[model samples]
Target: MPSGKGQGEPFKLEPFQKLFIRAVYEPQLKLRRVVRRAILSMARKNGKTALIAAIVLAHLVGPEAIVHGEIYSAANDRDQAAIVYKFARQMVDLDPELGQMIELVPSTKTMIARRTGSVYRAISAEAGTKHGYLPSLVIYDELAQAKNRDLYDVLDTSFGARDEPLFIVISTQSNDPEHIMSKLIDDGISGVDPAIVCHLYAADEECELGDEKQWHKANPALAKFRDYEDLATSIRKAIRMPAEEPKVRNLFLNQRVSPHASLISRAEWKACAGESKLQDGEEVYLSLDLSSTVDLTALMIGSVSDPCRIEPHFWKPRDKLIEHSSRDFGSGSHRYREWAEAGRLHDSPGKTINPEAVALFIAEMSQRYRIKGMAYDRWHMDYILREFDRIGLQAYEDCEKGGDGLRLVPWGQGYRDMGPAIDALELAVIERQLIHPNNPVLNWNMANAVATSDPAGNRKLDKDKARFRIDGAVALSMLLGLRARDRNIKPVDIEALIG
Candidate 1:
């Protein structure tokens, strides 16, 4: 409980605790910078919390401490935040000498030095909650589960103010690529750029994930404290679970399993690629990517079938080099009308469609079939949003609205949240819930689709820069919009609430 030496009291640090100390305070560490970022992926009972508490105490009470120093512990959940708090509390409870040196500030979840008034606090990762704080040191525990990326962004901004600020992000790798913790790991390993990152994951070769031996490599205290034997049994069941469920075990438990283990192979994906034919009584989902003068517009119609597939329903401007001929562009052509009338076509006309025209389109589609809500890229489709307001349509906004009718849908706000929206659409497709017409142009967009991951393990559509201009946002929005309309929900009134 009592961590660092308190008033000449006897003290000994754990191995990992000693490592944390050297990583942060060693003068040689500053000189070499051999490891600016490090991951300590120990097993569950490896005393990570206690070690972190000791480090926090070291920063607070160590001989070289700065007066009025500030330190923080951040986590994905409130419970995790409390772990750091509990650890600090334990240090005081175990040693009255240590307790005499520090005062617990109940109001702010902090431990304070009686002589200097330095402070340490615990924080949680909720929306718009992690700002306006500066700390000399930060310890992020169990970061792999962090759902919000904003917390990382806030800390990043704080780092620029002072070069000496110590930033430590630690976590058990989780399935979420979108999680702040996972992104840090991925960025550390990819070494795609100048930064050299450090990570000690279970070597895919050394241990069959879940094997106690394999898990121990990443965790130092596994032999004495971790429940590795029981975890091994669960790993087998996780491998057998469906696409999404098992990912949780693989990521957090450090198991090796493919979450997106598709029943269809690449060849099937290629063969099925534009071969989806619309049948009578089939419902189709439409995705629209609008364009301006330089950008090409796109619309995709995906199946609402068991194979859960998406293909392009339409594409624009056969070739960028070719002139905008009525024949090549197919503007005002019968083929365009055929799909347009079928309500399977999504169009973005290089600029925001006229408010009146969009309103008419939405209304017309709603009357024909359950026209679900539409999804558009908020970043690029500024004009479209204004048009929605001009027409008195409600869209979700994030703000302090005093009971205005505008309910802001938090999920529709950014590229980050768009990942979940796409996953939802994919699930709908796999469930055989969406239907669409097979259009040549739409097929083209689907063919060019690529996948990318952000630091937090979130999957995203990668629009190939060299190939055709494909807007997965547009496609995703169309699907979202359709789903929304079906649910009788309107886009949240972001302006009203956030403003």
Candidate 2:
């Protein structure tokens, strides 16, 4: 191993590095490698890339060497892939003894030890030519930045031929909680696989962001190899600009925080959680948000009286859940599955939401509770309206257009309507006038919501900017808007509305 601290000096392994090497090299009593896969997660400037380069070289021509051994350093892009390879080549060139033994091929980014018949190379996901290569040792550098799992799967599956294959992943925490790197970290934390070893250095969730102690916990080399002054400067900048806080925490604190700006404070949302169930005979207003057929469709019901109770019905395409559950960008579907199994979400059949099923659910809700009116967005109203028509429900015209009966109301999704609705809902939540059943699906959507302000200062939930589905939140806002209208109008005969 070569040191990054100085030129041509033997690398002095940190205590944590030594422990990792021991775990990988020291076989169990059964004479088998204890750890086949290792995941090392830490903040930047922690010598992660250099450490990974050293390990790659060790397997190439050191104690773990094998005849005709194939080792690779893989990353999301070509520049990232070259990082470890360049360091390894530099290490060998800096030392006379290692230089004499190894041959560096800069053009192809390869290092070959002719005597041992071992080779080290660098590859990236964009190359699209990773398949058909059997790798004995694989080092995935900055795996969090990878957009997909194609390269990861290719390299992982290619190792089955080797008797003692080793896969090492070194990366900083990703901003996306649903990313592949985050999934691996979650698995490592669970400790379900005996052959997998994980070392994660991160600040505690409750730790103050400005605390130096928390910074030291996440960055092991804070004052040493990593400059303390540089970090302090960044901390000061983050404090001055609220927009930079999430990026700083993700990169420096190694926390899996959401990259999206929050619409509501998490503390306030959690504070509003309580046991509030709706009664069968209670009069309720229904709101539906059908934004995407293949994505999430949300229906929210709220009681008319004080202590406004809410219940959410969420639907997603079942096939999409199966297709994306194992993907890196598919965290939403995985969570949906969990919520579905918990009986808090509904899984519609095929690749799109079943409008008939949604209509039937509304009919069932109408039978249980006296539904005053249902509010729906006008954009994708055709399918939903047809379903309602098939179910014998009348379409209510706009009150300004000479409408007097209770039916489905076409609610505009612009800033004018959503702005006031959001404000009212927020006030209700703060005043403890709005009660919910503490639904996890709805809670997740609320947490994923991000607010967007129009030029005139009106704000609404921005679906594009939200981290995940905000259909639930949008539905709730619509329900609040309908509730406002319900207070001014009289209820129509149930028989006439259903006919």
Candidate 3:
């Protein structure tokens, strides 16, 4: 007997639930959008479906609602769409009050409001299904897994017709930075809105990777629905030997797991550095890493003609890298700020650099050499995107969807394929197929890299995951692989493009 003043008792709201109700009903709230985003991040199995069902019932039966009102619940897959429908059905079955308010068409998995003639339908996101319906409210579930993402375009078109239409998108975090769900989460968190969006997420940066206590925060239902002790044991086993990437990321961190672990140790990766300068007639491929902190900004180039060989063209530590460091750097006793003042290395202009200046540098250098393509992680690299857009530089955007024209090479698979690439490079060096002018800084950076693997057997550098990272070693490898893949170079490319 859940306590409620209705014909059939209503479900009790949690602390977060009360907060969510206020977000939904209080139009006077100035920060309604912000509050809603917070609600979106509530842990899974915290009665999400029940809450949604209750909201639907109110819209259908409440006196203020419009007649023949349309509501839609959408998920990335048909199976997931059924889950929400099941909740609505269960509510109708359990509660005598809610049951009287609606007529369920069980065959179609739809609910029809008797007085208002409103309808609620469960929809799976398909290529163009959303285009035909003018829904008063639409729920997007598991948006991260949407196969085509055409639902976004259709929803955009439909939204213009209704003044007070409600849109809700909920999904677990996904690894693909390009995913539509991820974009929504990012936009919601940044307070970018015409649509009110909300997100709930694990505090990834603050939480220990495999700590069970921390895991429970993001998965509140672990004790009730899952075996908490078993989960803890599994996590412990994952990191114990070979350092499994999947169990660490997926189970604990709630991030997409990298597919494979590396054959080579991080220490071994650190030993594979070579020179930076390109030999005569050698075509180069560039990979860039834009600095977020006063971190290192690197541009690594690899020779495409000889798959086994790679070289670094640029490695500049932003003025901030060593600015606060307690360690001494050789005879140059002056601080990192001193290097910036002397114009020896580029310093961050302030919190960020002038996009135009950065663009000009890339474009100018690109023109000066026979570069195939520039590959970079777009995460936290918006400055680069804007700069490239402004400068008329050819860049790959929406590459997975075939809009960008430039080929997109995936990482994570790099570690698995690096051994072959390394062998090829070694052979190239012996055969004189590869040649370079030695650059000590590039060599130094390469000597500091580490490698790790995922369950799928893909491999990537552990530098991003490690406490100590090399200057630009990871970036160098990325550029080399990108160039090779772009050229359709055989036998030496990372397996991600093929498989």
Candidate 4:
């Protein structure tokens, strides 16, 4: 019974809460429980904390209690972990029977049963000292916000020691599709594991944002615990501001929208992808965006003809490839390793990028294509420039004259330069005038791209605002800018024409 609201009263469980309790407690046979793992996904402000608190209390001292049983509720941070603990403590204080039977220690965030030696503790991911506990029930609150999978993996696998362990993951949908929580939800939905039960409350993909029916679909507590007036205000804000729509849909509609603000719509970008392949010995312009050893570096090549055909090359360090790939870099670096295995990406040795390998690849590419010009950001290009010189390629500034050979041109990445370039690329994608080989690396980068506008209304792709690497998009934009200025090819002033 919960007692904090007014007086020590019997805890009133909602229909959804009752259903969840039955799902957790109902036995398959005489003593065996049906569900070993339960995934509860819903929108925000849906009484998730209160329900989890009740379940924690039930495990600690109620009929589910076992002798010396250990129960844990974990979150990404200390404050989040304390949320459930605080609510449970309030419930204990409000009820006389619970207050007498439970001993609450606020300092350590632990509650112990007086008769039974069962204990409940709240822990955070940062406290990497959770190795010894053999938990009977583990409640993972807001699993979507977890930074990595270390704590989850440790706790999940440690349940093997218990006879009937229950792992309950209650979370909102993460904006990042590659997040561990998202992956777990996907696996749960596959229904391969009968012991795992998944309850997902989300709006349909075709449902329009701010639709009342869609809102009701995602939020079970719409008129019960959740206030309709507050949701209506949020809907108004989301509909009025285009930038806030994705976040609103993600948090309220339970949609898997991109974490970062997107520069291009996914549908438009997908529409532009085709089976068009770049021909050998074709006249092409190239652009390079170099990064330090630990980050991603990209080289994008494209023909200056109509329906520009683009190809990309990416490189990353080889050391700890698996570990780095598993980390959530919005889209996850696993895609990088996958591309490398497919021979589409270059995995350089050690922790830093190998400039020699990059130069070698460019030199080889120069042999295949009549490389007219190469645009590169001036930052961190000293080693690459020296490597180009070693390969008998000349480095030229935008203002400098060059011979009829492969020339490296210094390209500015500021709004004045990148604004027109991004605008041009967007126009090409929307008009279906650009032909790409449907490179997954480039597609991921494009999905991660976010645009920021200056006071003068000129916009450029902002890397800091983006959730993942946008090097491919940046390189392609630079190449497009250079191609637009070339006298040999008829330039399309896409912005001017559209305006």
By lDDT, the best candidate is 4
TM for every model, in the order presented, reads 0.49, 0.78, 0.52, 0.78
Q: For model 1, state the Cα shift of residue 359 in Å.
A: 22
Candidate topping TM-score: 2
For candidate 2, what is the total of clashing residue pairs? Answer: 0
Query: How do all the candidates rank in terms of TM-score, highest first?
Result: 2, 4, 3, 1
Q: lDDT tens digits, residues 1-499, model 2? A: 4454554667777777787777667857477577788888888878887788788878877878889999999988988878778888878877788888888999988999879888888999888844788899998988887776778888988987898899999899776555668878889879898788888888876466689999988888787677798888888798898788777787888876667656655556767777678889898889989867787789998888887888888888888775645452532236557667888889897888888998888878877988778888877778876887798755565554554434677877788778777776776676677777778778767878888888977878887888767888999988986786556533223225325
Models ranked on lDDT:
4, 2, 3, 1
Q: Name the better of 3 and 4 by lDDT.
A: 4
Write model 1 residue lDDT over 197-290, tens digit each, in one string.
3344443432444355555565555444444555555556655653443353454345322244322122223343333454443554555555
Q: Predicted candidate 3: what Cα RMSD to the true structure?
A: 17.3
Give the least accurate 10-residue stretch of model 2, judged by summed lDDT: 489-498
Q: Which residue runs does candidate 1 get wrong by more than 4 Å?
A: 1-38, 41-45, 127-130, 190-197, 203-212, 236-248, 255-499
Q: How accurate is candidate 2 locally (lDDT)?
A: 0.78
| Residue 357 error, candidate 2, Å | 3.6
Write the residue-wise lDDT of candidate 3 on 356-420 in tens digits: 66567767766666665666655446776677777787766424454442333434425555543
The per-residue C-alpha lDDT of model 3 at residue 394 equals: 71
